[model samples]
Target: MYKEFMQWALSSDDSWAGLILRLTLGLVLFPHVAQKLFGWFNGPGLRGEMQYMTTKAGLPVWLAVAAITVECVGAFLLLTGTGTRFAAAGIFCLFIGMILVVHAPNGFFMNWFGKVPSGAEGFEYHLLVLGICIVIMIQGGGKYAIDKLLQ
Candidate 1:
């Protein structure tokens, strides 16, 4: 069972697709992670983000913390093609939650042209992230991945 599990998790038959997906997801998510963790991109820093997510966003403190950690750590993992599946799964769940809890209420279209009242963006971006994550989970980390080295 352990051997089978390792085989499934570490296998990387297709390289380019996973490479593209992993890089894309990592690049896109890294900025958001930086925003929350370091206040880069004019985002709230860790303390501020925690407060806003828990108070305004109504997310539990633990969940908010987990989200922040996952985004930051997962980005690095995906970028290096190490633990890509786990990172993808983490990001997948995070985007899905964001869609359900935050973006869905805003409707399908993004806040393009600053038209939305709440100024919150829509779920389209989250859906795209989710799709990428799904592809990563299915395809593994491809060539250049640490998983390949393990194999």
Candidate 2:
């Protein structure tokens, strides 16, 4: 069972589609991770993010920490094409939580034009990311991925 699971985890094809999806997801998420963890790109740093997550978002400290950790580790894994499924799954759960907790009330469209009265963004971005993650999970890391080495 362990062997089978590991095989499934490490499995990937040589298609460029998987490679493109993983890389795109990783690159897009990295900046957000950097903002939350390191305060880059005008993002709230760890302290600010924690406060928001716990106080405003109402997430427990541990869950908030886990989410941040997942984003950080998942982005790295996605970028390197290592443990692609695991990384994609982690990110997938995180986005689902975001949509449920925050973006659901904002509706489907993003606040691109500041037209919404609430000024809060919608779940479209989260949906897109989730879709990408799902693809990566199904396809695995493609060409040049370290997962290929493991397999």
Candidate 3:
């Protein structure tokens, strides 16, 4: 089942479109990780922001590092088509964790307006991204990707 899906996604001869998808996803996600790592774009920055989140969330420090690497560094790898599958898989895992830990509290509807009994959070958006990354992980970045050229 999985292999078939991957073959389908990579079936596109229009490598440019596939490349665009890979680049967009990778570039867009990096900022979120950056906020925790470098505090760029008004982000909280790693030392204070990430540490605080780790402390509050009762997660380990390495978890923060892993998330940062996957969302930022790994995404860059995806963009460059270097280890595309590995990077996409890493992102899939990270997004799944976020859906469970962070966004799940927001609830499926993403109704931060105190809906779903509050603290319900949401898994909707994070899950969506996770699914997409999972697809890319299995399919690869398509023919135009650096991964293909490397092969």
Best by TM-score: 2
**Clash totals for all models, in order?**
0, 0, 9
Order of the predicted models by TM-score, top scorer first: 2, 1, 3
**Model 2 — TM-score against the truth?**
0.96
Off by over 4 Å in 2: none
Residue 22 error, candidate 2, Å: 0.3
What CA root-mean-square deviation does each model show from the true structure? 1.2, 1.0, 4.8
- Candidate 3 runs further than 4 Å off: 1-14, 111-121
lDDT of 3 by residue, 32-135 (tens): 76777778889888787667658866678888777776687777887786667777778888878877777766557776566565455578767667776776
TM-score of each: 0.94, 0.96, 0.76
Q: Per-residue CA lDDT of candidate 2, range 1-75, in tens?
A: 999999999999999999999999999999999999999999999999999999989999999999999999999
Deviation (Å) of 38 in candidate 3:
2.1
